[model samples]
Target: MREAPPNAVAAHYATCTALAFSAVAVPFLPEAVLLYAGIQYLRGFLYGSRQWRAPARVPLTLGRRGYRDATTRKRGEATWPVGTADGRQVWLLRQDLAQGCAFQGDDPDWQAASIERLVFAACLNRMGAVVVQDHAAPPLAGRIAAVARPFGCDLGMAAIDLHASLTPPLHLTTSAIEAALGDLGLSEKAQELNRALSPVLRMIGTRHGLNALALYRAFLDAEALSTLSRGEYEIDGLTVNTDGPASADAAALVDLQALGEAEREEARQELAPYARELACTTGLSLTDGLDLGTAIAARRLTCIRPASPLTAVLVQALCCEALAAQEPVSGSEVLVHLGELHALSADTVRRFLTSTTAAGAIGTVALPSTPDATLMRLVSESCRIRFEHRSTGKQWHTHLISTLKDCTFSRDIEPFLVERSGKTGNI
Candidate 1:
């Protein structure tokens, strides 16, 4: 033949040997990564857990989409070979998941994650299950439900997992899955699915012979079956609402690899300032807001509002846009996710929101109307200056509030003083 291509025999032999040894490897996920950044990851994990800001709290909106977009994946059933146990087909869950993931700037392989999720969904289809996830991806209410939706309907869920987030991870249990399944409102089939799958999961655990499965079996037995079998849950749900197909649009996809390094560098240079400003506004970082705000700011507005101490509405919008990014969230799921990032109480959040809404400060923030009202009253009561707003219904209040943040935490919230050359400027 045509001079049997160079290195063909050697390549073939090497490929054969590699494929033959595929089953031979690490004892655990840790073993796989140890040769790499195992020590670094461990160090980060130990130190990082302390940095979690908010205590674990329930999500409002049940992980619902705060806003809508205009895209649709429109995937058909042929691609999703794994239909519901009763054989109900779904739309392009893969594309939809990607779009939703785009909404969050996150992406996991739909085939694999969805397969795993569908297996669990298949197992828990009869009842709403509460699964303690031991998977690589976090078992957030929205994530699980996102994968679950294309699989079936009337599935409500809640999840409780161990602190083993410290470990690379362990395995999940049938009971844990069942718990999430039943914990939320699920269909009758959901319960039946879990009941059937629990034993099967045990058998699979026995087969894999991994500790995760063994522990999963133990967890299933640890507590009596919860009253998760109630059928009312599908109607009375807690969280995990999708932003739907409308939000599935709003993106223009391109290949980063397709651009030259020079072009990429130039683009980064141009976008850096916009990125920094957005990070400040959203309380996300440059990296996090890259997929969310910069694009919008560049295309729509030069600036955005609620720049700091981000309000609930802003958080909701950021979440919507962030989800569009399809990446993991930094500050979206914890205590801060519910809108309270500071020590401020609920009343304070409401008051600030009310004031901003009334003042038309939603798009552009100037200053507080009541910042120096006492001074205004004093000036009006005592002097004849008739000190009023300048041109734009804004005056010194603009300067103070605009400067308050820069003053407040810029240097540990410096104090402000009315008189004298220097006082510990209060804020």
Candidate 2:
């Protein structure tokens, strides 16, 4: 057996310790770290009000490529083999619930993190579900899952199951989930945590392709609209129609079409906020402009998906590329900004930037009369990349759209911002 490296071992210990203590103290979505198909397990516990236990170590099996693997008893706490009502079994792995951390150079620890994600994908394969519950957002989760696809698994969507397997399993409607969330004793505590992190989420929205501020404003707007319209209103799904005619290959309509009525309703309650807000503020209906923008954003993200370690660098760089004609800022400035956002070490950020710059994924310009002053810019607004099969010499070209011309947020997040700004004096 190959012994784990010292750094990997240390990181494992630190992560497990943090998760164990935190799960015990704060029982908010303790199973949220699960990659896919674990949402039902979470719903079961949360709705059933059962006493939840943080499994010490999940049983794992590493077998030959085609052999049936048997579970090996590992170190730490005993693993739990919790069977879902659908007859699928998932072991509560180690106490660590986090998927992966930010890049820390080309170290054994980073490899270990990648290994964990691979294991997660494998587990999802066995459990047989493609939806993931990612607080980070669907696009990012989709990207990471795409990276792990080579491990014989593919993640489909980012969502949570609204029902748990019980006797005559309860399928929750949108209002039901909302009500349950409102009354959960953990909501206040979770809110406190989210409150602390909201600013950070907003600051990196542009660079990360998430647009947190816009999403939040949309959510708030949906809530108000839902209330005012007495739950009769709906945000129709539309294709993105920007920068000339929308491509048929543009992402399919952003709809909950794949889900059952209850599932779709619940998901709509969660995601439609962002989409509807996008529509209202832009004066674009779901069928006209908003969907097109979503398609564009989704299309841009395709290029970001296949690149790892380079993911953040590419995401930030693409945003910069779209927002300006010339190098809006020096490569060093962008590097520093990314470093602060991701909390990466100077060395790791520098190396990532250096490698990508050399590969021409990122472009730089020299300032006049300034020695060694090269400002970073995007390579192009859009371009095509070719990937060739090594053995067959078969080649395919993929068109990559590096920028979204309509990546705009709500004006001051509109009505929500106005109230929060205290410009109204008092209620």
Candidate 3:
């Protein structure tokens, strides 16, 4: 017989191995090993072969007139070339894997489901159940098997959450909030509770089945609200109770006056403007919005309240803008600035800036504002220096970003912005 060429000899051995597993060993396996090996062989030949000749590339031009990608097309009066730099035409290569890479970021469901699918596949293989009736058959059934195991899915989810591969917490702001909600098992229980509540929405006038279930299950006692501190959510100085007795402990009561005075000073202390121009623009006549702005400019700080809600800083910012602007600031104007600054809702902002009751909040937006706010602002600004005792105090000053050092006290507080332009306040 004629001697087989070296490549042909190698290919013959590979083909023998492939057939041995595909036809001979397959009969004994309810397991996926035989099938997996067979499919992988084809997969390698089609996609991962180093020995195979590269597919022929045909150049195609997508013009300034635009060609179809079937999903998105940039519409503009711009002309661009889509050919090779050497003047050779460029060819488009479509890769199945490349298409997957487009949406590489993980969705929430991926954590649990991906794990479940993987573990289940392994288990199925070990159990002699990993099977491929035909090489051409899709792997949907296998994927479904892996994804459907409850305990396996749960464990996978746990593993995902436990691994903090990339993200690190700055101050525990996000993690703290999540931890405070509850542990992992609680989340699953809560999900189950939500499913149980879905049919009762129209019966009880609640829309979110999950959230509504959580709320109802949260407190078993109706009187729980009264027993809890009602002041939990209110600002330090914001609440005034006309009807209730004091909740102060004996030790607290002893220093109540001193504490009260100190807190008053805190509220009244001229805070550093994020930027001077923002201060001036808000139109607070209290000591020239410029001067207050200057002090804040000196200090790269905003109102420091550990207890402050997410809205506290935002409202403070809105007020600053209103006070700075020379024109009468309508609610809409404040909302507009807020929109420009961050994507916060007008409703959330309204709580901090506007008081609908006849008696307005201490820091309501005044149309050219009442003279009283101006006078108070002026008096507060008149003080040469307003010192705040930060937790780190002097050392903390070093950590202050230099970018903020150049900023002036600004009325332009937002969720992310530290200061605004043109206004000056002392730190």
Provide the TM-score for each candidate, comma-separated. 0.15, 0.19, 0.15
Best by TM-score: 2
* Cα error, candidate 3, residue 164 (Å): 44
Give the per-residue lDDT digits (tens) of candidate 1, residues 1-427: 0122334434544454554456356455444433334344443333322221111111222113221111111111212122221122221121111111100011223222322333232223221222222124333444444444444521523232222222222122233334333333345443553354245334333444533233222323212111111111111134211233322111211132234444434444433333233323322221112332232222211111122332223333342332233222321111111211132232333333333223222211111223345433332222111111222333121111111111111011111222111322111
Measured on C-alpha atoms, candidate 2 has an lDDT of 0.27
Q: In model 2, which runs have C-alpha deviations exceeding 4 angstroms?
A: 1-125, 128-138, 155-427
Q: Which stretches of candidate 1 lie over 4 Å from their true place?
A: 1-167, 208-427
| Stretch of 10 with least lDDT, candidate 2 | 409-418
Candidate 3 lDDT tens digits, 77-100: 211111222333222222111111
Clashes of 1: 49
Reference-based lDDT, residue 282, model 2:
26
